[model samples]
Target: MEAFVQSKREDTAKEPSLFLLPEWMEADKRLTAGFTGRGGGVSAEPWTGLNIGLHVGDDEEAVILNRKRVTEALGWPFEAWTCTEQVHGSRVAQVTLAERGKGRERMDDTIAGCDALMTDVPGVLLTSFYADCVPLYFYAPEAGAVALAHAGWRGTVGGIAARTAEAMASAYGVRPDQILAAIGPSIGDCCYEVDGLVVTEVDRVMDELKLPEGERESCMQRKKNGKASLNLKELNRQIMIKAGILPSRIELTTWCTGCRTDLFYSYRVEGGKTGRMASWIGLQER
Candidate 1:
């Protein structure tokens, strides 16, 4: 079953379309976790709708409005919307009260130079932008902790998944086995073709993984044209498994952003200039 469930709704300007992860949210009413879709925002073309990225070329006012709409839909206070300046690295920042709402309005004050954010601080909604790259979410309910990570191929090679788990352990004493993880919507192997540099780096990571031959082939397959089809989601899941997260506790989404352009913004298919979706997870104060 898909982990991210798209709630059906009209694409009106008032409410943005959302794909929610109820496995975490419903289990604990205080938690709000979901990914935004490509509709129902006020951004102009290229970004078009619901573009929650301030880094993108979308107008400042439009991007801010779109983010406000998402916060409104989640019934979360806009002040709790914390974000990161994603550099496609493995760095994870431990968000605290000081970092709360750091990047909601503009880019100048966002948490700098981080692709992953974890917080035990309630009311700090952690967010990261995406437009095909994987969004990995982490939660340790017993520890009152939640994390949001943005992993592109670069971050994947840098082992961001394991790094995130380690950060949670160090900062919150949350064991990897106790962590609940979800790999959100991203480019699937069916549409993610790669060559040269990507293929070489992926090879290095796979060798480090030391996966069995059959299991290895499932993650990446070379094509007749010398390009390889990479299953980033599967590979990231394996990385999480290697980090000690139980396979049974992980939920992987089947939505392929590259193929679902109507419902998502594909940075690859929608041309290089396009909008980005937001992956958010946080716990409200009791």
Candidate 2:
């Protein structure tokens, strides 16, 4: 589908109800974004509570209600959320005016084969599910746009975060410097060990982009066993920087999913049999 430029005003807010909301951006009533930790949902064991992922073997009804609770907590109408079927690719979907209610009644239709979703439409929440994959959020207040991306090794190697940022810039006329990014909790460098193939791919991308020599090595440091420990959060942060976003405009969470089992579900720690956490961003209605 062809992407069109849109005009709107953007602001951001975050909640502090035990959720990992950003303190610096919580005062604005026009933007809402947060990650639901492993608490406050209705799924039973394995899935536990506050599991917002419907495809992760959680009870469908419970997932629905949990989604509702999250929306209600944000004071947004429950029907305004928009999510997608995330394929670990670099594709970014630009949400338009017509897709406002897709989150409630046509979720399946909204499940495009993409890793990122962006919108300038106010009150339309954009969401993505992640276990070990990094959840990245983008906002350009001056352009009135926001985007959410799920970046696993595949997506990272494919440059999904950069693609999402580029989409926002192209579609909303947002300067890279004006974009604010958040690197949410994920499998940190302390726990994410990868094979040589991943190391090679990451190196190849870094070389192709001519990323800073020190930054690249810092993200792909090796462990004693020769297996490289990948810092996805740092890699993605570099992606944003390469895309022209200023360092001061980015915020990162120090929580590691693999380490904080009580707060987040980690696919690596749980052998792929774990619930997924939801990371979302949206513009509130004026």
| Candidate maximizing TM-score | 1
Tens-digit lDDT string for candidate 1 (128-215): 9999999999999999999999999999989999999999999999999999999999999998999999999989988998988987
lDDT of each: 0.93, 0.78
Q: How accurate is candidate 2 locally (lDDT)?
A: 0.78
Task: Give the per-residue Cα lDDT of candidate 1 at 213.
Answer: 90
Candidate 2 TM-score to native:
0.89
- lDDT for each residue of candidate 2 in 48-70, tens digit (9 for 90 to 100): 77777777777778788777877
TM-score of each: 0.98, 0.89
Model 2, residue pairs in steric clash: 12-31, 13-31, 41-49, 41-50
Best lDDT among the predictions, by candidate number: 1
Q: How many backbone clashes does candidate 2 have?
A: 4
Clashing pairs in 1: none
lDDT of 1: 0.93
Off by over 4 Å in 2: 1-20, 103-107
